[model samples]
Target: DARVTQTPRHKVTEMGQEVTMRCQPILGHNTVFWYRQTMMQGLELLAYFRNRAPLDDSGMPKDRFSAEMPDATLATLKIQPSEPRDSAVYFCASGLVRSAQREETQYFGPGTRLLVL
Candidate 1:
């Protein structure tokens, strides 16, 4: 079984900085999701894609957070002008939806760690 891979597992940055994280989904997976974990917001869904088409991103912080798919196996998340509250563990998940309304199992990458000082 293939697995999702992420780079720069840990990052430390100053306030109002830019952070970029990368993820490689499973080879056959067509859906990718980006999420941010925080004690206050809990698990916040940032964005997701189905067949490389963005399905929803209402939970994302529009001013600073952005997600994109440069290819089938690659997904990237960027945070510009990061704040102290932006420090969290960002996770990338990939899966295939067997049905339009239902989602298949998502395999998670180890995640990229970000810290703002």
Candidate 2:
């Protein structure tokens, strides 16, 4: 039984605290995706990677958001100096899609819910 797992399902932090979210995608999956869901952004994709190589992260706020894969079994998303506007649900998903040229469905984790004051 394989599944995506996320840590800190809920978090509350001050206006300038650093927050880190973790994700464990299903085994054998080679692509990972990060998305942020907010009232204003709806479901906007933040970043994407294939085989640990970033494919596109144009949707992410480059100033404070960073995403990476330390290994095949681990992926992380970090936010520094989190702002109130950053309050939202962050999700990590993994898939077999190697590129946009292929249409592999992504499976989402439970998501990390963050609130900034």
- TM-score of each model, paired residue for residue: 0.93, 0.93
lDDT per model vs. reference: 0.90, 0.91
True-structure Cα RMSD, model 1: 1.5
lDDT tens readout by residue for model 2, 1-117: 678999989999999899999999889998999999988768999998889889999998999999999998898999997999999999999988655566778999999999999
Task: Tell me the spans in candidate 1 whose CA falls farther than 4 Å from its real position.
Answer: none
**Model 1 clashing-pair count:** 0
lDDT of 2: 0.91
Any residue pairs clashing in model 1, and if so which?
Answer: none
Clashing pairs in 2: none
